[model samples]
Target: MTHRIALCGDLLDLTADPGWQVDAGPAVRFRPDSCLLIDEAGRVAGVEADAAAVDAWLGSAGQRVDCRGRLVTPGFVDTHVHAPQLDVIASFGTELLDWLNTYTFPAERKFADALEARRGAELFLDALLACGTTSAMVFPTVHKVSAEALFEAGEARGMRLLAGKVLMDRHAPEGLLDDVEQAERDCVDLIERWHGRSRLAYAVTPRFAATSTPEQLQMAGRLCAAYPGVYLQTHVAENRAEVRWMAELFPAARSYLDIYAGHGLVHDRSVFAHGIWLDDADRAVLRDARASIAFCPSSNMFIGSGLFDWGQAEAQGVAVHLGSDVGGGTALSQLRTMADGYKVLALQGQKLTAWKALYAATLGAASQLRLEHEIGSFRPGTLADLVVWDWAQGPVAQRRLEVARDLHERVFAWMTLGDERNVVATWVAGRERYRRPDATAIPQPAR
Candidate 1:
């Protein structure tokens, strides 16, 4: 029922979590400089990149896309983002709570207007693709209009997007809070309309425990328990002050993570951001629940939050995924997030290897979101959503990659220094969405 497509490129084939010892099956490793990905009937049909394999796969009769000398990897999975925060990203520096109150909260308030929300959705997706991200898990504003606009934008772009109507019924500005009854109702409506519709998915978002009342948490817990496929997202151990607020709000809870686990909100499909302040007990809760923590290094440092103990998290078997965290995070580049993550570890007498960073952003994050089977790697039968990266897109990057002999080192150099400029092209579902100034089409950079 769908058009068959094949793509030729230097695929970043991965078969395991870079940080873990698990096999990614046959897809775990990429060949040096070639691979073919075929999409048949809207599902991945074949994968092989040898000249003969590709020629045979094409068979002189399939729609073909080619990547010439660019790094082609699976679409990036941004496990954490506030779509409404796009307008306020890179605002003048302020601390976490103050920054939220000053720029973030105020800007998100405007998303209640559907037109404004839609405009934001368009801009946000454009910005994401311009930087070569094909799919993402995002945080919508507390407004239902926000989720509706974001999902619509993702649909238009043919992306695998997961988002939700952010829930908050207390400890927030008046307009941002949705009463518990209405919050769950909105989430149920979103699921009925968007979840599993094409590649669009729904998330049960509670903003954070601090902003949601007990009833709101219980409602989310019940909904997630009933809908196993729906993702549960919230903030945990992000800031000490926020943790303290949660403790005061839920005195019966043993720990902040306990609050969510006690309510049935913690589960295998859950994704929480900012574990910078998490303790052993919190890590245990996350591990027991099989929940993923989106390690927001840039956001942690940007807000003067304490460094995340990556080694510690891993030792405790907690899944770690990287996110830009946008406004609270200082950079739009997940590559930059890698660099910041390294710096955070370095400060804690630890190190973040290039392989670790790449894994966290790509396959590791995808596993956390439970979308790996469909999109995380250049496997046969996966949608042809890919990015073409210019290893030497700019002078500085060119110089860096020159002496870098290893894949991890080269990727690290590029990550620490590159931005959208390194994005040579971006594709969605076998279609060219952003071409970096070639005969096919021109990418209109986000203004």
Candidate 2:
């Protein structure tokens, strides 16, 4: 059956261009009483300012979902997330290296079983949709079955997902290790099978410099080159200890970023997670390569990693995005991630306003992934991946919204205090994927 939905009410349209940065404060267009029409094709048909105009256009053709006083915005885009790590979120204690050895590795090894992988993928995707995230770049375990399972799950749900099998031949468990020859073969097989299929895309994942040998990193780079527009994701300078280890592992390289750059892994499509310890030289290299950093503030704070230098990253012209970095990240909510990000920057005497934080999680992250045109904005012809936020979901939130002087203050209150519960509904491609039962009454589908 053809599906058409009209979401009518307050809307927060992030009309800013893709290049908008933190320095461009509160540059969003908020419509207090508006209507967003999604045609049967699952694309935004139009946005109307007058409710009467919207009614005239609908004219008994589609279902209208009333959101008279709620906040609607683009679906959250998670730039970096680990699907298998969902089970290990919020594990106590330990910094980067110790935490990985103690928790992350062991949990990820469970993905070797296809059933476990499928189960994990289902749970992860459900959690993401419930939290208002419609698209993500994911890292599955080293097992090809893990990537296959994730791809299958994402395809079934019609999600836009970018994932790759983790490639690590050294400094890891034997069960998780894949030699250079086997790693490249499996990656090629996975890419051929899954890349550009449905809404699923491929990323060449190396785990990190410490986990992969020079040969393996080169293979990852070669894979990226072989598949035009394929992405590259890996860790870098996330921990001081990890940085030192990488330096010792690749002594000939000028810096940690040099290791990836030397292997041709650093490029516009590359997304390096953490980047908490990036030096000026590393920033320069990233700028030159036009690479992006997934600024994982929640993970950084959860695992006691150092604060990310947002100021320096901006000053150096390096593209920055946000991530949950789950397990180590403590939560899957982008709202939580943004809140933690604000606190992290606050510690450094910097401020992340509500507008910038929300932008970083949506269009900003999409821009970093080079998917701004398709997923970031509500511009006509874009996919109808939307999040409807109900400010009155809770007493505290309701009270806060009641006093919010303007759109900025209302958004600030929501982001700082909101979580998955506040997401009234999450829509993917104009189909209602998740709707909070507790939110204000929504119209039932027409017979």
Best candidate, TM-score: 2
Q: Which candidate has the highest lDDT of all?
A: 2
Q: Kindly list the per-residue Cα lDDT of model 2 for residues 1-447, writing each as its tens digit.
A: 286677887877566642324344445767777888888878888788776777777777767788787889999989889999987898987998999899899999999998999999999998999999999999999999999999999898778899999999999986898899988889888989999898889999999999998888888888988898899998888888888998899999998889999999999999999898888999998998899999999999888879998878988989888999997898899999999999999999888888778778888878888787778778788888899887756788889989988767887889999998888889888888888876547766551
lDDT of the candidates, in the order given: 0.78, 0.86
Worst 10 residues of 2 by lDDT: 17-26
Error of 1 at 258 (Å): 1.6
Cα displacement (angstroms), candidate 2, residue 222, comes to 0.5
Off by over 4 Å in 1: 1-6, 20-28, 438-447
Model 2 regions more than 4 Å off:
17-26
Instruction: Give the count of colliding residue pairs in each prediction.
Output: 9, 0
TM-score of each: 0.92, 0.96
